[model samples]
Every structure is written in C-alpha cells, then in structure tokens.
Target: MTAAGGGAAGEVDEGPLDEIDRLDAAAYEAFMSEVYDALGGRGRDLPARELHGGLVEARGAVHRAALTAEDVATVLDGSLVEAIESVGRLQTQLGAVGFTLAREAAVRGLHRDVALSLTDWLRVRCPWLSTQEAAQITEVVKACDSPVTAQIGDAVRDGTVPLHRAALVARTMSRLEGSLDVDQREAYAEIATRAAGRRDLADKDLARVCHQLVEDLLHEAAPGERERAAQELRSVTTRRVGPGLTRVTIDAPDGVAATINGVLTSSLAAPAPVKDEQGQVLEPDTRSPAQRRFDALATTIQRGVGRPGAPPSTARATVLLMIPFDPAGGVPSGPATTAAGDYVAPRQAAEVACSADVTPVWLSADGAPLALGRDARYATPAQWKALAVRDGGCSFPGCSALPQWCDTHHLDHWARGGHTDVARMALLCGRHHTHVHQHDLTATVSGGTVTWHV
Candidate 1:
C-alpha cells in the first residue's frame, strides 16, 4: 500500500526519489527485455505466453504499489516519463504482431491493407488508444513494408519518433497513397518519417510540411497534367443558425472576391461623423462593426430589389467550359475544363453528367454555332433548383458546403462537344473544387456519395 521505493514515511531523503526513478525505468525495461527474448532470441517459432503473463503480473504489482505510495506525487512525477516511454515501445511491438497476423491471414498471399484489421480490437479493449490512434499505429506498422519508408518505420519501433510524430508520419503516409507513384511516394514517406523521428518539424508545422511535400510530389509525379485546366468553381450561400440569425459564406475568384471583401469592410468600418448646423463636428457614430454591416446589407438589398430591369425571378448566369471533343463526330471525349482552367476527373464528371442542372448543346467542329435550338442549350431555372434540392451541398466526399454555395460544374467541357443539359452537371464548392483539380484527385460518385482515392 505504499511506493516500493519511497523510504519510510516523512523521510525527505533524495534516496527515495532516485530509487523511484530507477525502479520505474527498470520495470518497463524488464518487460521489454522479456519480449525481445521471446521474439528476437532463439526458439522464436512458437508463441510465448507464460513469459508475457509473468512480465504483466510483475509490472502490475509495481504499478499498484507506486500508486498507493505515501509520496504519491514523487512517484507519479518520476513514473510518468517512464510510463510513456514504455507504452511507445509496447505499442510498436503489439502493432507489429498485429501487422504480421494481418499479412499472413490469407496463408497463400500477403495483404498490405493491414491497419484497419486491428481497429475493432483497439476500439473494445484498449482504453488508452483512440480509434484514430489505433489506426495510426497500424499505419506506421504498414509503412515498414515499404522499402523507402523502412528506416523511418524502424524509428517508430525503437521509440525514436515518440507519440505525436509517429502519428503525423503515419497519417501522411496514408494520405499519399493515391497521390504519388510508388517510388516517389515511398521516398517522401521515408523523408516524412525521418524528419518526424528527428523532431526536425514542430507539431504545428508537421501537417503543413507534409501537405506541401504531397503537393510538390504530386506535381513531380504528373508534370504532364500541370498545363491542363484544373477546375475552378466558386459559390456563395447562407445558412440559418438560429431563430433570428444566419451565416453567410462566399467563395469567388481572386479579383471578384477582393471586391466582395472590400464592400463588406467598407460597410462594417467606422463611419465619418456628421457636422452640426453651426458647422461644428458631432461625435462619431460608435455602433459595432457587425451592426453597421448588417444595416448596410439591408439597405443594399432594398435598393437592389427596386432597381429597374432587375427581376427577382430571372437572372442571367454564364458557365464556360473548355472541353475536348472527337473531331470526327463532334462528340465529347474528355472531362470538361471550367473557365477557371481546371480539369475534372472522369468519374466525377460522370457524376455531374447524371445530375439535373445541365443541358447539352451541339456545336460544329469549325467553331460555328450549329442549328440546335435554344432548348438544346439551356436548362430551366427549376431544373437547377431541383439539382440543389437533390445534392443539398457539395458532392465531393467529406465536403459540407451548402448547395447554394456551389457552382454547377459541367462534366464534359462545353467547348468540346458536351451539351448544357441538366444530366451533365453537378455542384462543387470553391475549396473542394480547387483541391480536386489541384492533385488531379480521383473520386467515384454513387448515389451522391463520393469515394476519394487519396
């Protein structure tokens, strides 16, 4: 019922402190030492149970005694460092065992998708490991199989990467799965792993640095696609947050975005004071910036609604796409390029092709307008409204931007041979649209659910 190493009660000797630290380190080391003997030493073919049970019992007794120690503070302070170091080592070993089981499960062939296989076990019994942690550890274990990342993976196993950095490297490796070629992916994974292990990048910079590396590597891997248009979609929307409040978000191209932001700033900024009848200046208006902006918006809406030739029911909107075509039949052959000059991936393009907000138009290969009537090139406003109701928001996986804040993206480029029909377009918000084309990401849309490859 007391710290095994704490000397008799109220004895303020440094000897007890030293003893606690020593015992804590020794306990964890002893457990790991036994594991190495079983797995790394001779006669490693069979599983060793009794040795592990004995080690666990020994560690448990020490832990219990330390927890009840009269000098509990001293015991806890010294033991915490050792406890963390011990868990890192233990995680590495257990994760490796799980990796082996997953790899060998099929008997005839090895499976590389090993990390997810252990999530169920961790979710139920491992109180300390979160779902994310379980997945991260497994990912690090999987990284060991890659030749490029093997060295870094070794660092994780040896506790060199520690806790946070190990998670960073593991998540980066998972993200790079579809974004890079085999060699490039492996090489950067190693660099990420090594940098993380060495503490070269701070926790805040780890993800950003990894992201830049991924972007650079993607560009390096597919330099050919750089010149092709990457889709550029922008939108704006509002959401009702409460009984009397709403949230508005806007995403637009750089120039237009600046103008919009400028308007908001001017509206919200402090106003100049008015002069009194005697030409003396009065006190400046001191309302909150938010209140001013709200008033300005309400005024603007009133004026806009009363403008001549500006009808609330009808608006002219334009979408320009630079699509490729089959020269022989004037048919579309490739994904459409938005006026923003971004390319759409084929699968995502197909998703749009099945939506209700696009209409097809026929054009000559010689750049002349064909005899196709207006109905062939235009979708009714109602069709677009229906499309919004169906999609609800951005169609890309994990995106939650509302439908009103999305642009109708054409699957096949209109410039090539695609029609403007409702069945050939889908909605994409500005950010997700940019990301999709930036990495040339692959996504499959089925019943409105998107499956992103990387």
Candidate 2:
C-alpha cells in the first residue's frame, strides 16, 4: 500500500501510529486469550511474570487511547459504583486474564494520572471493594507472577482468606520459590494463614517459619544440618532475656557505691556528674530519670560496661523511682522526706519497691531522695479508657483498625510538649505508629480528626 500523508501521492493515508495501535490492541486480545486459557486449565503453564508484563504493556496502550481526563473526572464526580463497575467490565473484557490482574493493570495508570488519590479513586470506582481488599489487590498485582501473589489471588477467589491475610501470604511467598510441590506449598501456606490470624505473632516470626519450610523442601540437608538450623531458629524465637524481673548492677565511675533496683541494665551510663561552682553537686541535668535509665542501658549495651566476661553469683537488686508533682509549682517532694519525714510519698515508695529488675533502692543526693523506679504516671486504666473513647479506633485517618489493635500515641509527644491528658493523646495501631515515626509523617489531632501531614 502507498504511504498516505507527509509523502508522495502513492503513499498510503494510514500513519504508523495508527497501525501500531491496531496491532497492539490485537496482540493484547491474543495475550488475554492465552491467559484465560491458562487460568481455566492449569495456571502453572504460563509464566505469571511474562503474562503480567504483557498485560501491563497492553494496559498502558489502552489507557493512553481510551481513558481520558474528562472521562475520569466525570466518573469521579458521578456515582463511584457505576464508574468502577464500568471500568471493571471494560477491564474484564480486555482479554481472558484473571480479574484481579486485569483490574490492577487498569488502575495502575489511573493511580498516577487521576487527580484524586488512588484510594479515593477506588472508593469512587469500586465501592464494592473494602479498603483493605483494595490494598491487598494492589499489593498482589505489584508483586505479580510470584507464588505468593498467585496464592493471594486464589484465596480471594476461594473466599477462604481475608485480603490482609492474603497480602501477608503473598509477601511471605515472594521470599520463597514456586518450585515447591503442591503439598509442601500448601503446608507453608496454611502455616502462613494461621500466623496471620494470630495478631500476637511477629511478622518476622511468620516469615522465618515460612522460610524454614521452603528451606526444608529445597535444601534437602543432612539430619545434622537440619538440627543445627532448628537450633538457630529456636534461638531466634526465644527471648534472650525476660521482662518484669531481672537483676542488674551499675558500677559508679567514682566507686562510691550507689544501688538501685528495677533499674534497666540497658540504661546504665557513667556520664560525669555536673558539679556546682563551689565543687558541690549541682542539680542533675533536666533529663528525666526514665531517660537517664535508658541512656545507661544503651551505654552498657554498646560498651559492655558492667557485664564481666566471667559469670557472677548473686543477681543484683532492682530499684524503682518516680517524680511527683504537687498542686503548687514548688519543689514538690525530694527523695529524703515529705512534710512527714517518712520518705517522700507512698507513691514514690511504691515505685522504688516495684522496680524489679534490680533490688528496690532509692538514690539520694545528700541523703535527700532524688528518683525512684515506678510505672509511668499516665498509663492508668481510666486514661486508657478515655483515650479509646476519644480516638474511636486507630486515630489515623482512613485507618479503621480496632481499639484493641491500637496503642496510645501522644499528640505533641511526651518527649516534646505533649501531656498525659486524654485530649492530647490518640490511639494508633502499631503499624501506623511505626509509619508515623519512621516516615516522619506529621500526625496531629485537631477538632477530633487526626490529620496526617506527610
């Protein structure tokens, strides 16, 4: 055929771009057919990665040609349910690929192109899908062709697992191999599901167990090797030390001998005491006793301060301490005495008594009590109840996590200006709390809505 435009008279009218688009559409159809056939029969026949890659490429072409800013805007403005259904139908017919994969590819470009956030997009377009489900679907598609991804899709289709659980399985499986036979894979998959169900199990523990299962299947090691691996695994699983009760001793730099109990071994440090102008001990710096204890523990851990190379006999005592605020702003109570001279207050004494990791002892400055180990001032049951009521759930916006699943988060931060009052605190799930601190997402509560300023 003769070339048409931008050429001699004999040239054909069609452009290369038009031809390429036509061919891409046809190729995409064929790819879809193959994927459908593979899923209908044994899904193992096709390489998931190759199929996913093709689908993604096809989606790019279709998205460029068929979807428009106007269409997206109209859809977002109109009924989200209708828009999602329409999109789902269009994506479903795009070829014979799995519905999960097709929907993922269709939305992939939309996430970047659409003005509204993808989460919002899903709400408008696929109102039938829960946020958790949408997140899981996205996670699986992003991890295409992996055994875990496949498993997640399978679970969704079978309705045996929730989206979150499926996502966890996919993540765990991605670290493993598809070479595992059906029986072995099923075993590990079941284990993964069970682990996901148990909220108390650490994610690392789940991954480790799944990894061990895969290793057992792939390595086929001798009994000795297996035993060694088991031992190492056990070591990792078991806590190196227990909480609540332990003994630790701090060797003062001056060797004057001060003992405290319920002291955190990790928080023992030998920072030089600040002295006054007259060679008398000035007020210890403003660091909280808790902060000092943590610093001491960190120092011991890093420098191996008091821990001897050889083992010792008797365990050290635990000491507890607390700071009490009087109704007036004046120096409330020192370690040595209250107005009664029977040792500061019962609350402070209790703190000293309960500091279990070491024997209970009070640290005094010139025979005046300074600090005692005790429970945090604000962790009362009533305060926690108020926090739960105010926050409703995990206070992170868009997160509907339950109360039991959350931890109290200080609004201004206790280390900063945040107080222990309920109004200045909110509940956040462990994951979101970690994300807040780790990713530096600024979370603040105003008018009862927790806003995240990333």
RMSD values for the candidates in order, in angstroms, are: 17.5, 23.4
lDDT of 1 by residue, 170-197 (tens): 6666655555567876777777766776
If scored against the real structure, what TM-score would every candidate get? 0.35, 0.32
Candidate 1 Cα deviation (angstroms), residue 248: 16
The residue-level lDDT of candidate 2 at 186 comes to 60
Question: How well does candidate 2 match the true structure in TM-score terms?
Answer: 0.32
How many Å off is the CA of 262 in candidate 2?
A: 40
Q: Against the true structure, whose lDDT is highest?
A: 1
Off by over 4 Å in 2: 1-91, 94-128, 131-376, 439-441
Candidate 2: residue 298 Cα off by (Å) = 44
lDDT of 2 by residue, 1-454 (tens): 4464557667656666666576677787776678778788565555876867887997897667565666766555457677676665454344224435445654466644433334445555667766755665665554445453455555454444445555667655544433444565566666776665454666676657666665664467466654443333321112225667444433231112223233443235333468978978776566766667777656645676354321110123332333342323222234433333355453333233322233333333334444432345233556666667777777665565777667665555332334566666667675566555544355666786667675
Error of 2 at 356 (Å): 15
